[model samples]
Target: MSFEDKESPIEVDVQSLDEPIDIKAEKKLIHKFDYRLVPFFCVSYFFSSLDRSNIGNAKVAGMATDLNMTDAQFSNIASVLYATYIPFMVPGVWFMRRFARPKYYLGTMIIAWSLVTIFTIFVKSYGAMIVVRLLIGLCEGSYLSCMSVIATDYYFPHELARRSAYYFVASSFSGSFGGLIATGITAIKSGKLESWKYLYLIEGLLSLAAGIWVFIFFPDSPHVLTVTETEKKIQADRDRRKAVYMGDTKFSKPELWSALDWRLAVSIVIQFCQDICLYGFSTFLPVILKSGLGFNKMEAQYLTVPIYFLAGGLYLVQAEISDRLRKRGPVLMFGTSIAIIGYIILLAVKSSAVKYFACYLICFTLYLGTGLNEIWLASNTAPAFKRGTSISLNLSLGNVAGAVSPQVYRDAPDYTLGHAFTLGCLVVCLFAVALQSWGYKQKNKLHQEILESGVDNRTKSRKHGDDDPSFKFLT
Candidate 1:
């Protein structure tokens, strides 16, 4: 049935042509897509990451001193954000999906978070601070998963990794600008408002603008976008490349049970491990540089600028290579290994230069594995509902580590303990990546076998894509 019909074509079979896949046409379509969707989302994401990580910069600017926050109290405030972040994730994604267009829900939530960022200026007491952090996390809990789902909806499986990388790298670029801005703002000692408050005010206004733009301009979906007849044909061809539902479709018991298996379990562990490091670095890097490595706050902020630049550059390279090679596993393995080396060097070194270099290595792939694995799971899972849930599960459970990360790094200025904990998590995550990669390899192998037999389980289940005998895992 057509989408116009009452019966949604969400689960309806979309058949591919007998003719060869049109590689050139698809590339052109994807390139055209790059200009339309990537820029605004990148700008939005830049603000999201800035608001979240700028706290580290704020800490150095004396937010802690002004509020009389001890190490433990600051840690609690950091972890409290994750309290709502975890529980609301699945619900948040569900809510976003339920909306007819993203601007209503996603845009509203972005604006909401930006308002919360602005509210930070009013946080005089510890209790008020806690409330603000929690509110921010609640508003942002669904963003990553929601964005991932939107990406999968628009792009082919192979294209998603690079597209996602584009979204993520902007966060890295924000670090460069966020640091410089923070450095400048905190230097303004004459103002009635503190430097951190200025950071919030500026970044929040930028985010509000971006959110409003999204609500006003973003299409409901790629299917609704105005395109030529040739573009429509190519899009239809794109639809046949995957089995995910495009409209409202309920998940069956079998589909749900199949999805909530060892893969999900592994993904949860991987995310848990991943976030401990991701947030650990984002939360503590500025303080770590100033306190532990003997740099002043301004010098530390400048030092951080280079790391973000390197991180964005490396991520683009990593994303390009992974997309071109059509393998997510190697990237995960390589990123983890580089991070491990960075951590080990941090522990081993006493020189400021050596320690700084080590941080660049860790920063290079810090956000990469998390982003890559999200795509890996989304592409390999069948049906739209399953893919959405998988993304939510990864994001929700993984973020719990964010709560834990602050405590481990609680002994900041001398955060050897935090570095150790993050190193341990990265190591465990490496193993998870290996096992997950092996699972994909095995699944692809079985898919080939079943295709030759012509008695595939996919045929029996009447499912396609990851469920199809011909489908192969990206890794």
Candidate 2:
């Protein structure tokens, strides 16, 4: 029989093995797996990333010259964008929890940012650019958090890391594609029309189109999709099984607040530090290659593509491994440590070829952190309302480092201080990962004690008499 026709496998009584089963429910639950969810999330993330990182490509092309700004001033403009992001993330996420569907929340932000990005092309001065960038950040701040919450709602905890990797790989590819597209557009210049301006306009328009598509085609949740009634029944059953496995039908406010404890705080801190390293590389790597390594602008842009592609591939591989292992701390630690090593090579190597190779290492290490960190936060949080808020807080707080990092790169020919700062940030991330790992172990031990004592698992409670003893961790 198909998954939809199979009875639900969840035994309601934790202690009863002799009771007759509800085979129909089991089938419904198995059949409810909506495979379309992944593609929707991937597409949403792709446009979100394209709009944000297109600025990097624009900066290299002619954004600085057109706006008549100094390097410091340009860096400050970039910083301002992220500044708004820090304060707005919590509020944005809270709004998503209280008022709007994820589809609506995420779609609106995409449309708004796209419009703002398009307006960027028409700005005549540095001040206007800064204002627009900040506004864009305010609009775009909630998309990542919303996506994280949505991912958890659909996938089991064990499956989240790999799913997150798919989302982030879209983001990584957008970064590389943005560069290539920017390079191509900038290569063609008309009288009075700057390539950077055209670059922003084109990307912004694409984002607008994507937003419209998502608004129409995306389902708010698996239960509301266009699937058959049989499929919907299956999906509901699966959710029930997941609820039992987690020990709760749905998250309560108190549970959410409790989940946002010290562990959540530490994850945010690690994300913040890691962002310092990541944004620094993403935003300024092209500039460094062109100016420091003596490559032309186009060559530098093209060269960065391979690094990003490899990084995206590595994110999926690492996330899969982490999921298989059912652990978050070790995965994060390993990823961060690799980032540190990459930065060391960048700092120590004098040869041009060696430095280029180090760029690949940096890409691998930095992007690897995305999947581990996103899954880590999602796994630890309860589903629904609190999950959305927690994700927003973590992402918004972590991204504040994005604002700080651009300022680290002074106008000097070599961005030595920026590289040094990134290295230091990676070290802090290493420590944070260790702390989180320890905390997870403690939480797991306590949970085991509770199980042994006949207390319900903090997640979903098993039916009173079911004897299945398997305790799954959200990796």
Winning model by TM-score: 1
CA lDDT, candidate 2, residue 22: 56
Model 2 TM: 0.87
lDDT of 1 by residue, 1-475 (tens): 1111011112222344455666788778878777778886788888878888888888888889989989889888878888877888887777777644676767887899999998889889889989999898888888777777777667767777788888788988888888898789878887778777888888888898888988787766666663888788877766654433332345445555556778888888888887888888887888889988999989978788989888888888898898889888888889889999999999988898899889999975677877788877876776667667777887888888989999998886779999999999899999998999899899888877887887655444444535666556777
Cα-based lDDT for every prediction: 0.78, 0.71
Q: What stretches of model 2 exceed 4 Å from their correct place? A: 1-35, 245-256, 453-475
The total number of steric clashes, by the backbone 3 Å criterion, in model 2 comes to: 27
For residue 399, model 1's alpha carbon misses the true position, in angstroms, by: 1.1
- lDDT, model 2, position 327: 75
User: TM-scores of the models, in the given order?
Assistant: 0.93, 0.87
